[model samples]
Target: ETLMEWQEQRQKPHVAIFPGFGSGHHIPLLQLAKQLTVYHGFSVIFFTAKWMGASPHQTPPSSSGGMIRFIELPDVQIEGDHAGMSFLVRIPLLLEKANILVEDALTSFP
Candidate 1:
């Protein structure tokens, strides 16, 4: 089935959190997802690139009769002389992709 059609079949109150690349962003995003699921009882989805090296130690508990989910995307490796690229040049790209992933995930929810 097509992606949009599959998304349309999902349950309600779904939220996708994207932490993007690097440990700094990933950690907090995971923590936030945990809090939302455990305390707030929200169905939270996490999106991260496979190359980011982030993984959950334990599965999030299911709520509202459905399970929490993690979606991983293929990592983008910019092959260039990073010896010259500045943080200003790379940070925005990371944020942009992260946002895109979150949007994609959200679009799947009802």
Candidate 2:
């Protein structure tokens, strides 16, 4: 069968949503994913950093539907030593690494 037919036969569409680093971006995306799975009947997968996976504020996945999945990636940290540097100096590097991790996650998705 064709790809579309195969997908239809399975009766589910897989969707991956990746939010930017930090809680500001992650919370909304996660809420949206839950809504999509619980109310809209779509399979939702969330790609987030390891920190999010360990967050205590987020809701647990729905147990009955089995439509949502969480994929946690390692926290992206700066490689070099910036000993005694100010927050401003390290912030950019952290953001850059997070962006790189996001790109890598997207490219590696199947």
Q: Candidate 1 at 55: error in angstroms? A: 3.0
lDDT of each: 0.63, 0.66
What candidate 1 gets wrong by more than 4 Å, as runs, is: 1-12, 51-53, 57-66, 77-83
Q: Work out the TM-score per prediction.
A: 0.58, 0.57
Cα deviation of 51, candidate 1, in Å: 4.1
How would you encode candidate 2's per-residue C-alpha lDDT over 7-108 as one tens digit per residue?
A: 763586667776755777777777777788777777776766654433413665655266666666677666767777786797678667776766777677
Off by over 4 Å in 2: 1-14, 20-24, 51-59, 83-92
- Residue 41 of model 1 has an lDDT of 61
Backbone collision count in every prediction?
0, 0
Quote the lDDT for 23 in model 1.
72
Candidate 2 TM-score, C-alpha based = 0.57
